[model samples]
Target: MQKYWILSLALCSAPLVSAQSLMVTSFDSIAYVNSHNGIQASAHISVKNTSASVKDYRLLRSRIGTTGLVDSNYFCWDLCYPIWVNQSQGTVTIAPGATANDFSGYAYVRDTSANGQDSIWYTFVNTSDANDSLQVMVVYAFNRYVSNSESSLPLLSVYPQPALAGQRIYGIPTDALKLEWMDLAGRVHQVITQNDGSITAPSAQGIWILRAYFQNGIRTTRVLLR
Candidate 1:
């Protein structure tokens, strides 16, 4: 179920008019697991204001879910907390031709839930002088189950196909898969145990190749991380 909060005009700034507007240009989501609890997210938010009047907004409130896993490393997952509101909101005033390009954050399940024992959900709400509201939802999980047996054996996908500078490498596997990341000169960087995942390229800036291996001696294409 979805939730929301409404504000009265008296609560807003006097200079903010009703004509201010907001436009969402992009939205996306992703899921994965690292050393402990897994996280599923929908991020990558970009917005614009097309209204004639100036717009001011603040990300003031948020809702987060919890997992009951009680492993010894429970505290390690706090880094996954969602706090974009505290970092991005403050007197964010935008002019008629102005824009905000980057808006993103993460929410994850803590190591307190029994395996396969919980459903996670969170919603972030923002407020602006124009009374505009933006809400985003994130879900975290351990693993995904599929009922379809007719799907292909399994596949891996790497994004930004050509690769670019200062960009994180994004990858996803279609089925249960294990991955090995290697550098061009035959060095094993790190092994990814999860299906849907991402890794940063070598910081020095050069062409690097990633070879992902799966069970049954099957191998996917080599990716260029530049």
Candidate 2:
């Protein structure tokens, strides 16, 4: 039998305005665990005010969920907690054309089974205007293997350590379905399909993360771009 668990966050109030001008600069969509002890999943999210004026916003509310376990009460003993911001009350101001310093949320889950699932969500609203807001959510799948011998996924490798601007390739499983290249800022620079099979480094020289999606699971690795 397989077990499932969930952790989530929600907004306490709805935005007053019908239109939102805030944009999420970057986000992470997947997390994983390989043991019964569980793991913490987090993402640094950045927001920008495209509007001409400054905007005031705050993290309104949050929630966490866990399910399909023998002891639900065990999660409360420090394994789970709510998302938070650096500000006093999760409030901040963003100037036009400027990006807010990274804000992040994290969740921890422990699974006794080989397979488990969880999720996290965050809601931000414009306190001054009500119309400008952003919601960030990430889903996590936990995999617990008895031993390294039980794993069958092929190793994923990226070549040209410190790849040049125009030369890069990911040595992935033949069954790979999609590839995503993301920069440090969390912006997705490119998406490649199996038909294309092209791996191009970002224009800027720095560190980048590559995500490979296969029929069985997903793999993420970092590479340096020269």
Candidate 3:
């Protein structure tokens, strides 16, 4: 289907040319990250040439299906490439029995307001072989993201895409059950069980999902604040 095709393309943009002639020493599968720090997370994965001959290896990044949870991530072989660049433009030739510690994988949390885990894979491929390669799974365990139910709720009318200063409410009935302001991960930032059609926006300055509890269900919409 169209959905799967898009995911397949997002996995790895480079053509397949890899083998297991190289030995990749794996690191901790999980990388813990704090979204509140607003810092980039990185993992060090070392590779060694296991074959008798000098092995040339290329590093590739693969973000497939629901595996990508971070805003952006990439790998570093000889150099670091942008997230858009799936494969390294250069390859490193490792002498037999020699290990290369120059490989490192990185990920970022652009949305500090929301907290959730993300995963990305780094693969070291032998440029000359067809069945030789090694992969590292870096699961960024974020202590911070969006709820499926809240995202699927009916859209409510909230003014200002990038809401300037303070908090304002509009189109919401004062008699509603209650109003709740939350982030994409369903973390409640502010809540008002009673108010005069007004809600407070968190100072985090990003897209936030706002909702109101109704008798039957709930209505939700996203707001951006300065």
Candidate with maximal lDDT: 3
lDDT tens digits by residue: candidate 3, 5-113 = 0001112232323545665554443335555543445566666777788888787776532644565665557765766788878889899889887675555556656
Better of 1 and 2 by lDDT: 2
**Candidate 1: worst 10 consecutive residues by lDDT?**
1-10
TM-score of structure candidate 2: 0.44
RMSD of each: 14.0, 12.0, 16.9
Better of 1 and 2 by TM-score: 2
Whole-model lDDT per candidate: 0.39, 0.51, 0.58
- Candidate 1's residue-wise lDDT over 1-226, tens digit each? 0111110111111122242365555543333333132222213344566767676655432434354421111100112222322323244565676676434332233432323422222212224442455444433333333111221334445677657745777755544355555443334455666655665555545555454444432233345545
lDDT of 2 by residue, 1-226 (tens): 1112222222233232343667766444343544464333334456777788887777643433454321111111001222332122536778987887436443333355646554444456777865556665544455665232223544556676768866756555566788767654334567788534447677777887675666654555667778
lDDT of 2 at 39: 34
Task: Please estimate how well model 3 matches the true structure, expressed as its whole-model Cα lDDT.
Answer: 0.58
Candidate 1 wrong stretches, greater than 4 Å:
1-20, 29-42, 66-89, 112-130, 144-226
Error of 3 at 224 (Å): 24
